[model samples]
Target: MGTKWITFDLDETIMQNPFGKWVFPEIVNMLKKEADTEEDILDLIVSEHLQRMSEERFLEAYDWDDIITDVAEKLGAVSAIDIERMVIKHSEPPKIYLLEDNMLDYLEQIKEKGFHLAAATNGYSKYQLPVLQKLGLDKVFDEVITSDSAGFAKPNPAVLKKLSDEGEIAAHVGDRIDHDVLLANRLGILSVFVHRSLPAEVLSLPVDKRAEQPSCIRLCEEKWHKENRLREVPFMENECIPKVVVQSIGELAESIDFIIK
Candidate 1:
């Protein structure tokens, strides 16, 4: 496959969470004073997040403000929203933009080789586009396809195919094996898996043990679509053992070269 275009996953593939650096640390520190321990607060938060991830209702859109405030109120801790507002008001604080390590140079390197770059991700366009702007990577990708535009998320062929032109050879690079690799395998396109966040811990467990409740997700989505439904969408049923896995974005570039040849 002589790949003409390479599409990438946004979060943790080449983009990270912007607020985690300052916002979360402050919340944690605040919680630590009131909670039994830092670890306990952390565990609470993680548990809530995992619960949300497993719940089909809250799976798609993450409400961080709600999560922080609710967690704060529950734990009898200082309001994270208040602390965040104060932090923003008081001083000219440091701003940390989200981008994966070595992502820029690698993208540039590929572009120099005349490869068309794009992004196909499972997110709302409103939120995801701003993230790309903040990272100054808005222009890096030739095109960006989101769930909003695609009418569905990855593992559904439509999202990736949104970045394609007729007869164009393409490869998708992402961290999630099920979302990215399995989707590519199904479409018979080149798949490159980047090991970033979300360790494949979900994979080691049996289907019943996994966190993703796809049936619930589909039901919720179906309801959502029915009220605002356009057409039918697919669901995540099974996982295929991924064939192309890499440790970093830099490695992805190498893999792209190897696969294309």
Candidate 2:
């Protein structure tokens, strides 16, 4: 029998940076002087990064230097010294927190079921590897595939195809619909959406009620568009839909059994 593989996205799936990704106050103050508004700083940073990413064909994993350089050039006011400071601050390693308290135990259970596991993430290996080591996840995953290592990011089937070559992929679990679900669906693997941070109740609420909540608005505007860069891409029903949805990693083992059966 072929090896049965279960692939997972690292960030916000099994683990996450508890502090979350945020612009430093000092950097914000520096950019504010050149930016039209406080929001413009963030807007320009994202736009410039995406523009550069398109130029590179999204194959290479960009670092802080690349983003800071592009943003600084676009602003046309920030000094190289200030830009260097921003890069230094942003380049610092994040403190990782495993979402599930018994995450490793659950993973071991899954492994005992004869399923080989993999972490297929968009993060660069330099960043992702350390997090895995800190969380002791380095010992659990059979394969750790990162954008830098794989030469492609999520939503691109090539990233997952590398693992598919080694075994029959039973399922791919992740927190993002656009990236994780889309990629798995494209490759005909069962997509499992794990809502680690957001619960189903928030999602089930009426659109109007959901709009009243800050989390829902952030999810809709920031996560859906800003982080994933899905604004330009045309939405397809099959691409964003997952075969199975679970609220936590604790629920994943049962879902995996149902999928393979």
Candidate 3:
């Protein structure tokens, strides 16, 4: 495949965050130590922080460390040390479900074929980077782009603009239609959506191509003698809808190989 570049998503695409179970519990425990009323603390501090972010709001808000401090102060008795410890504990990662069957092997295959690769996610860069390293896949990416750094999240054309600015990217693969497929489609990059969590019937709407998983995409090469039904699905949305849907990153490679050829 003569494809120049490929981009990917992080959470649910590469890994899973057990934060709902582990991280939340840790936060609750720390809150217990504070001398303030839990009611007021949860409402004022936590709620305000969770509100939607605008450029102005983001600039006005506390940085990551300061956010921790605000939460601790709300408890009236929590310590910075405790907050730090909790963060460190929860940070133990890869947080991804590294499915056993030679996952990295497929990525290496694409790399060997000379395609540039990147990751564009809505997550924060500071936290997302550590998870990639834990999976030992950090070195695979030529670039790691995140919403925090990009100043805009997915479905935003500006983020796609960043991808184009870096180089000529051929495809963008991700799990969500709204953020990944739609946005990629709008940006003129071939969009490939992996239906790992969603069923095929549910996505029966027109897509350039479809597959069960990343590995299965190899069928494009495996059955070279057979006519490949590959589709050059373009981005789509207000003109941004993704044209292709696959099951895994491996399949994304296969589709790309077929498209580029």
Candidate 4:
């Protein structure tokens, strides 16, 4: 395989939220308790920004003031200033997917093989760095670049390219076809898709093949679960794409064995 560089995405690829979670909207809805309509509106404003951060090229241009003011008007607060309380509430984490056990060890194995390990995350240093440190990846990854740092996010290959060493053949491993695998394809790097939580039936075949089956969409309804709550998986999203897929970083470690060794 001759793979020399390996980059990763943070949110779902490495670890997920403490719970199988929805990001901005779900958190905003939760924190919008009856303190005041102003408080709720403020939460909505923050949620709007976080949603934009994940979905768009937020670093290139963002009108935070406009987002806040518009949200204030929609919530009948009249002024964005009216929503601001003196006592200060910090912004909640945009996403806080906890690291799973041994995900780091897998990377360590990759590192031992002498690959230049790096991270290309949608999240910034303030949030992403701490998680890496907690997972003991603070020193493991040669570079930890982010959307805020790079001015672009996933599905956009620019971040990956910018963070790449420029001399090495690369592979990127992450959990999303929309973001990670797509980035790999666009950048002409090897793509390794990870699907840890899927049921055995849907995972009976590689994702690219399984995704083509009519049974794929149906399986999402029956098998995708966390905390005993079933939710529809975006199975169709994986279709006939990302020639490589694995369920865990340990699997990732194995897939890279030939190349790394």
Candidate 5:
């Protein structure tokens, strides 16, 4: 067989953008005047997005413009110009941080072992590309495939099929059990789950402070459940179960070797 490929999920797997997922909340705050309450607007935005995802299996089915425009029309409050401006302002490149120390070094070491590496993520190139550049990982991957580029998302075997076309995929690493593990299991590839536990400082932050920085609340909540050994989703089926699990990316190389044996 040709050189095997090792794929990774970008967002919570390789890096953490503390504020990336909180963009919608920030938008609700900006348009507070247009809606009756911030909570109402936020609920509408999230519900509408979820509805779209349900109908269109692709994660990138509807862009922000479509969702925001629909929300505005329902409320009949915000203007087109204001919505456009808010989207632009909040869409700036987010400050990204590596989830683990020596992330780049670890990836390079894996590459040197003769395996081709690829980043198979469920995101648009416009956002994911800048993240790789910021983390100095732009040169590490032989291929960087996003949902927008692949025209498909995780848990769908088609995304991995594209990567497999270049070379056989030996394994896939990601933080999500549902999306990442499920996708790998379906394709008969080794699935590695990297558990991202937040630092004590982040977990102990005041509730008010967490609210000030939107993603903190989510980070803290997830960490709490993990620390307590609780599962957010009650049951895990065979497809969703990862073949191997590690605490951090620093241990990823060893896990990959374990799978190879």
Candidate 6:
């Protein structure tokens, strides 16, 4: 039988959220609007804004409206609806790092080879799903698992367990060695490490496989650079690692074929 399942990691694997940039300001604005003083506003953002998305018990009761009301009410606000309106207005056309053109083609090729795919990444679905839709490859994957959805983020065995349960993932491809590769290995699932250059933190992990040519990643970096938009695209300068690193997603098919055989 074919391997059938391939789980992937988002953010630096499929997309990248530039540091110090996001929709935080809008949330902050809402806090400021409701609060009587700056101290009160900061307190609300600190108290309510910084919670783990996977806290299901908290999130189950805390929908978007609840989140707005909770934050606003913490600062002594009157209307949750107004805060939600501002939040949604600020959240309109959710910001996303777009995927490379080759991504769609590569995913199609992988599916043609009979592989089922899923995404296992950190962050809530609100932030993550938009990027998938922007990539236009949302329909390609059989499932998209998120840390928020799973109630745990990467490097956590629980996330991998949820990924495996989705179908039958034979392999997981990602950029972080500790969070992605090592986690996969812990569960006895094959791991493929992407990016030719890795951070010292990631390089410290024992990686099973590596790849450098991440087209989707490259495109996102290029767009950010071209747009002069927000944060700088982090690029690795060294090429000294001693592992086989391919330049494109299509190359993964060949590498996996050899490994599976």
Off by over 4 Å in 4: 1-3, 16-35, 38-55, 58-98, 201-240, 258-261
Per-candidate count of clashing residue pairs (backbone under 3 Å)? 1, 0, 13, 2, 0, 1
Error of 2 at 63 (Å): 4.1
Q: Comparing 3 and 6 by TM-score, which wins?
A: 3
Task: Residues 1-261, candidate 3: write the lDDT tens digits.
Answer: 333777877676666644455554666566666664636544444444444232224322323445556666756754554433443456564434454356577777777777877888877665566567767678888788877787777767686566576567777777665457666777777777666644445345333544433333433223221211132333222343346766676665555566654
Error in Å for residue 125 of model 6: 3.0
TM-score (all chains, Cα) for each model: 0.58, 0.72, 0.67, 0.64, 0.73, 0.58
Provide the lowest-lDDT 10-residue window in model 5: 205-214
TM-score of structure candidate 4: 0.64
Clashing pairs in 5: none
State the local distance difference test value for candidate 3.
Answer: 0.59
True lDDT of residue 22, candidate 3: 59
For 1-261, candidate 1 gives per-residue lDDT tens digits of: 444777888876787644456556766877777766445665666566545544432324344555667777887766435543533432222343445556788888777777888888776565566567656677788888886677776767876664554446467777665567667778777766564432355334332223243433343234333422222334333334344555567755655566565
RMSD of 3: 9.8
Taken over the whole model, the C-alpha lDDT of each candidate is: 0.59, 0.68, 0.59, 0.58, 0.66, 0.55
Task: Using lDDT, give the best candidate's number.
Answer: 2
Give per-residue CA lDDT, model 4, range 9-118, as digits (tens): 77777754321233334333433442246455545665666566544535532344456556645655443231122101222234443355677788888888778888
Q: Give one digit per residue, the lDDT tens place, for model 2 in 1-261.
A: 888988999888898732135333455456667656435665665566567555544544345446656666666655553433343344434545688889998898888889999999887666566568767899999999988788788878988777678779988888887678778889898877776456466656532243345554444344445545633654455566566666677777744565566
Quote model 3's TM-score: 0.67
> What tens-digit string does per-residue lDDT give for candidate 6 at 51-111?
4222323333224445556667766877445433343334323344533446667777777
The better candidate by lDDT, 4 or 5, is 5
Per-residue alpha-carbon lDDT of model 5 for 79-176, expressed as tens digits? 55343344334443454667778988889878877789999987766656766766677788888988878878887889877767767898888877
State residue 255's C-alpha deviation in candidate 4, in Å.
Answer: 2.4
